[model samples]
Target: MKDDIVLSVVLYSYLDRPIFDVMLNGSGIGGANSYGGNGMITGIRVPFGKQALTWRLDGPPGMARNGETVAMKNPINLAAEQIPADAHYLAVNIYPDNTVEFVFDKYIPDRTPRGDQIIDKSERHGE
Candidate 1:
């Protein structure tokens, strides 16, 4: 079987509530924004160009499992070549029936910080 699948992971809160609401991490001022409902993590339109997946993550604290699950889809010809290095962990195997089993790993980066929030706050107060 050819390996072909893509997935991403994030530390989301209130994601497993079984509803459609999902809270996503946002930029500076608004720490997070709600996107989906109960039991929701994200809403992504799939079969998107590879360029659409270049994600930038900020320094995080630890690896957290997203209790909620969301899916994005793409309908492309399956080939061993379409797989990315990050998706290699998916124990790809072809079944005798010609169906492919793609067991993938969660794509996430270790949490890291660019700077000190306390210092930034202090600077603002002094100014």
Candidate 2:
């Protein structure tokens, strides 16, 4: 099986307010016919207080147009300021084929009770 790289980081708000700054490093190579790849991020959605947040990176649709080359050599430094800080979660998913996707979300605790709450055999086996 081909191994992929996935990195995740959680940041907390400094004060009671919902704000945060984040930075990440990433690199990618352009398509074989293209000169180099380009990196971009698209903010999916930022909700209200106690609400969830979501975002992702640009996909194939945003890539270079019809046989063009864009050279990119230096490491890509991604930074976001004043982003929602409520239970923030960020991750970089890199596939074996070099395709990358950035996922961001706000984690909310689940308070619902279900039958799964009861210990199952798989749980006992640490599966």
Candidate 3:
């Protein structure tokens, strides 16, 4: 497992609809909840190399109610040289325009640049 890296992912959205599915390397890890602008966080073990992260959202141009959804994928290179020594977390913010921002951090961030919508998964679910 030496070639594997543990990744903590925080997924959220500023779109009208929440991202219901978040995937890494095309595999589902979790999703971003829209309720109160809250987000969902999950951790996964992936290889230490080039990776692809994708998410599914429902709204505009597309219609969730009509069984239509929009999905976006972004490349995430997990090479050792790319990750900082102290930053071990990955946080993603999905925007209304089907864009996303990826951030690396040493600790899980309290909230995204927007506001107090994100809470630890454990704290949110009382686990």
Candidate 4:
């Protein structure tokens, strides 16, 4: 296996919903992968709130749907920002083999969530 490098950070949380359902800015390494069915990889769902998130770097997980689940096993604690947080956050890095390493701050009230910054990071996912 090659050295594990930072792939992307999935900054999102489900909160009361108990599930994360979107890939923040940073997603897909070595440039965007336009394959797998519709060829568009969309949101990713962690098992529950305040949990680590994972994804298949080998193949795209496809658009969000039922039964599609990922987990935040490494980071025991989730992170949030402010008392009334809009969304939780999880920093993740994807290894070459397709295994994702979630960088869990393990603290509630994580950094602010911004869609603009999200896509901006996505632009640099593989970079």
Kindly report which residue stretches of model 2 are placed more than 4 angstroms away from their true locations once superposed. 1-76, 108-127
Q: Determine which window of 10 residues in candidate 2 has minimal summed lDDT.
A: 12-21
Model 1 lDDT, residue 91, Cα: 26
Residue pairs that clash (backbone atoms under 3 angstroms), model 3 = none
lDDT of each: 0.27, 0.28, 0.58, 0.32
Summed backbone clashes in each candidate are 14, 0, 0, 9
Candidate 1 stretches greater than 4 Å from native: 1-40, 48-50, 53-104, 111-127
lDDT of 3 by residue, 9-126 (tens): 6665655455666666665666555522334345666678766666655445655453335555445566766666787677666665555566677887545664333334434774
lDDT order of candidates, best first?
3, 4, 2, 1
After aligning candidate 2 to the native by TM-score, how far in Å is the CA of 24 from where it should be? 7.6
Model 1 lDDT per residue over 8-77, tens place: 3232211112222222222111112221111212332223223211111222344342332332232234
lDDT of 2 at 97: 26
Off by over 4 Å in 4: 1-49, 57-73, 81-91, 96-127
Please tell me which predicted candidate would have the highest TM-score against the true structure: 3
Model 4 Cα lDDT, one tens digit per residue, 84-116: 233333344333223334444334323234423
Residue pairs clashing, model 2: none
| Model 2 Cα lDDT, one tens digit per residue, 6-120 | 2234322111111111223322211111111123233323322222222122225554332232222233333343234453544332221223333445642221122133223
> Judged by lDDT, which candidate is best?
3
Evaluate residue 23 in candidate 1 and report its C-alpha lDDT on the 0 to 100 scale.
Answer: 20
Instruction: Provide the clash count, candidate 2.
Output: 0
> What lDDT score is found at residue 55 in candidate 1?
16
